[model samples]
Target chain A: MKRTDVTARLLPKLVKASASAEQFAPSNIALCKYWGKRDAELNLPINASLSVSLDYLGTHTRLIPIEGQVDEVWLNGQQLQPGARFSRKVSAFIDLFRRDQTLCFKVETRNNIPTAAGLASSASGFAALTLALNDALALDLPPEALSILARMGSGSACRSLFEGFVEWRMGQREDGLDSHGIPLDASWPGFCIGLVEVDAAEKAVDSRSGMQRTVETAHLYQSWPLQAAADMSKLQQAIQERDFSLLGQTAEQNALSMHATMIASWPPLLYWQPDSVAAMQKVWQLRAQGLELYFTMDAGPNLKLLFQRQDRDVVLQHFPNLETVEPFGSE
Target chain B: MKRTDVTARLLPKLVKASASAEQFAPSNIALCKYWGKRDAELNLPINASLSVSLDYLGTHTRLIPIEGQVDEVWLNGQQLQPGARFSRKVSAFIDLFRRDQTLCFKVETRNNIPTAAGLASSASGFAALTLALNDALALDLPPEALSILARMGSGSACRSLFEGFVEWRMGQREDGLDSHGIPLDASWPGFCIGLVEVDAAEKAVDSRSGMQRTVETAHLYQSWPLQAAADMSKLQQAIQERDFSLLGQTAEQNALSMHATMIASWPPLLYWQPDSVAAMQKVWQLRAQGLELYFTMDAGPNLKLLFQRQDRDVVLQHFPNLETVEPFGSE
Candidate 1:
């Protein structure tokens, strides 16, 4: 089904625009990653995924109805050219909400993390945009509807709608009404994430194209859905039981399995640099020396380390320049 | 069913040793790798594989009857103690040939390539030993019998028995009689292998244990047998048609797929060092700029680059310290 069709079904035919709206959505790191797409058009995943929001590390978007022919998009205080890729994407997503109406938006979005470095700035960007658009148009939709709308911008954006741990259900229906993010009830105050930035340069292959390539060519991808499903269950159990080891191991394995599929793809998508492997070896070495540490990587060279509050100093000692985050603020 | 059973069925019941015998066998690089085994005892593979012999890069072995209670084993210039791992393994393999006969022999072997660094030294080592034993006992065994005997020592040893392109057929029978190497008639004189040694240290995990761990723990391993079969067909076609691109692409992808399965396993069997990834990036960068160079890695960090003689200069220009070898002698 078309993305427009879903948006049209859920949104009102005629709506009054508010003066302005602002919203903030935290970025999330997937414990069970959302990889291959089941429906590329609607951005439906092949398997369910779970993630934890990075609390304060997120995006803040402000939307205002503009009396112009085209949408003006500004990212991190810099106005983007209308022809720019990021501007085009934002305009296209806004078109879904505007529908037949000739309404233009002045969309200004800002991310706290590095943009397009696989830190998932897009997740919070799209999510905050969705929430801001809902408020700007005076469309008082529920959190599920907002999440579904945000997913149209980027697949992982669905999980950014909620705080703490969230699960994105890969629903059975073709229209994808049921596929939305649900925030988990459990919270671990000691859960910490250490961002080891190997390289903040733009990724050579973006996640969308990479995912498409993996789905098309990788033979090992046949087993990914099963792996993701199993990992999702393990992550859910780990979160519920407050099992740090289970969470760290499952997240690391899931991320590695996802990368394995990419590596097995034609042309071989390896996002890791020499330094990336070095950091991984360091994590493995420290873990061997009785430090409770694990790392997960996305479609870029950077590593997001998983650990507890007690090991923060040790992790920082090894990765001296580590950017540590406590998802549930320090007690 | 067992290594001893296969040897007992193939060899003569009683044999007289000649005065002395010497033989050499080439090391081999698998285009389609033999990964998981169906029978660990008999070294029976779960899938058929193909490889090319490394011309002069191999092992030389000499055997002689001795007046001693136990076999004396020597590698290179140093005599190995009987209790050493290498010596025990050599003695165990020699026992297969001796059967119930109470005979002792002096076994000496030497490898041209680095041992236990994913260079497949054991392949040539066992193959040379098998040939030397056949000559010493005057067995006058056919090439198939010789290959089968070498396989009892190491799985890839079967391929090392032949020069040029060879295929090891993973047979169906429980006895594994059909599982042996066959030399292909086709040869490409310009074919070359460039050994880019990232590390010569003994592998952290040997191929045997790595294969077992992948099979038992990696969920993605379920696709490996099919991948091997498909890659084997492509490689055979490439060899038959003398297509360099096809040969290079198939071999590289097959190797990466094997490593992918290893990476997906629990504890993650990553044989790659930081330098290994750097070398791979260099190859990819060179390929992007219209170079026809491709690389394959085994159970260690070293990369064996595959290219034609025409591109040898360009490959060497990028990798200045590359140890170049013409698998099919330069015409």
Candidate 2:
């Protein structure tokens, strides 16, 4: 096929100019981390993962179609340099929705969560970006379709289309037709997330490349998908039963299991810092002293603590220095 | 039997004082890391591991029998506090040689390696100490017996008794009588080690407690011992065949597999720092450019670069600021 042939075949010929649209998509933390991909091109995960969407931390994306030939991207009040990795990814994502093959995009995104610090900022960013693009182009695709497209930008971004407890099921197909986020709950009462920043600096390894390396080299990575699948069901059952203790314990273990693959990667990737250790120790101590809380971290030194919203005062008291994030519609 | 009665039965009757003796023991780096224990009290490993002893980094110890009721211990020119945890461990280790329960001795030690920065300082220290104690008291214990005693002090310490390639076989006995280091080679020509100090501080989690937690909580730990056993045989074959590439690849993978258990620990014990990641990246880059070297780390933030002695200058060139360690009889 010629250079523009695929675009012509996939995209519409001549469409009227479409107006701009904006959408707010909240960030998410995977209770069961997605560590590796089966197919990198399609962004298919090796295992299923469950996550809780944050009420506050998110990406607000504004999308506009222009007559120009190339997509323009600006993030966090600064225009991304042309040919940058992120700019290229954003451009590629918009390229997917080429209803008007000539419609270039102007994308301005602002994220409340720190980028690449393991808060799944890319998830929220792509989710909102995909949502706004779909709306702006009058595609009116369902949320599941939006999630599948958002996943092309970043694998875990699939979970951000749904609120509360969401599971990204790794579909049983070569083409990944069935894979998408399933909302397990609209809301889980008394659930809260505490963000403990162990280090604010950018990670040495990005989650994508890190997980790819793990999948390629780590021997332990071979055994993780089976356990992760088991954890998905276990976590779902705990959610249905409202078993906080079981849910928290399984979530914590699943996160650690995901990290175990990274740690066994050739050259190894260690994400926890000294303060990350201290915070976990404090959580254990608090649990011993009759508090209900557990912690999970994803590819960064920061720890996201899970607890009951009713115990917010006590939980926040223990982490006086930490920034806290509550679930949507929580007191 | 009662504790005191068993102690009395284990100890020999009073004998005449014996002459003092000195011994030098080298530290070892596990190619296949030992992460868990079958018996905590006996220091029996969950898996067999292969290691290479370093030439320069070791502990030199001298022992002398004395009339005092309590053992006198001095380390690196300073007397360790009597009731400190290390002092107590050393004392208990010496008690195994108690021909006279009231017999006391003076022990002096010096280590070229840092104590707890994952250089296996305790391995070398206790290995030398036990060797010297066995010599001084004229107990004439065989090297295997000495290794067993060394294992009592620190699990991996047993590997330090032998020169060159060593294997600490995780024996199947509960009494741990057969768990000892088997010397694989007196020397292997051209094999060299380059020490890169990522962080020269004591680890937040020591290997013993760290492995204890890993064994208790990490689900992956259950699967590691089997892999470790297979690696042990593969490493021994690589050593026997003198296949540098195969040996290096297996050693590197073994170290990472050991670390995999720690990453799945309840709180997770991460031993790498940012610079550690940098060093590892450099190693991978060097390898892609065709350098014959691999990295293996213990329980701390240092990496041991395995290479050929002829490539010492080239390896040292890559890490000018980092300290390097040469083989015992390298040119």
Candidate topping DockQ = 1
Query: Which one wins on TM-score?
Result: 1
Taking every candidate in turn, the Cα RMSD to the unseen true structure, in Å, is 1.4, 6.2
Candidate 2 structure quality by residue, lDDT tens digits, A1-331 = 2213333433356543467999999898888888787878778888889988887789999987777777788998899876998899888777667744677878999998853345767899989998887778877677777777777778888899878889999887655656778888556766888887676434368888888888877777767876687788888888888898888888888887887777776665766655565676678779878888888888887788888888889987888855667665666
Cα TM-score per model: 0.98, 0.74
What are the clash counts of all predictions, listed in order? 0, 1
Error of 1 at B58 (Å): 0.5
State which candidate has the highest lDDT.
1
Candidate 2 displacement at residue A71 in angstroms: 9.1
Candidate 1 CAPRI level: high
Once fitted onto the true fold, the runs of candidate 1 whose alpha carbons sit more than 4 angstroms away are: A114-117, A200-203, B114-118, B200-203
What is the Å distance of residue B200 in model 2 from its true position? 6.4
What lDDT is obtained when candidate 1 is compared to the true structure?
0.90
DockQ for candidate 1, C-alpha atoms: 0.83
State the lDDT of candidate 2 residue by residue for B1-331, as single tens digits. Answer: 2222332433345544467889999988888887887777778888888888887689999887888778888888888887877778778877767744576778888888853335767899989998887777666667887888788788888999988888888888767777899988546777887777766434367778888888886777766876677677778788878888888888887777777778676665666665666677688779979999798888787888899877778888888855566555756
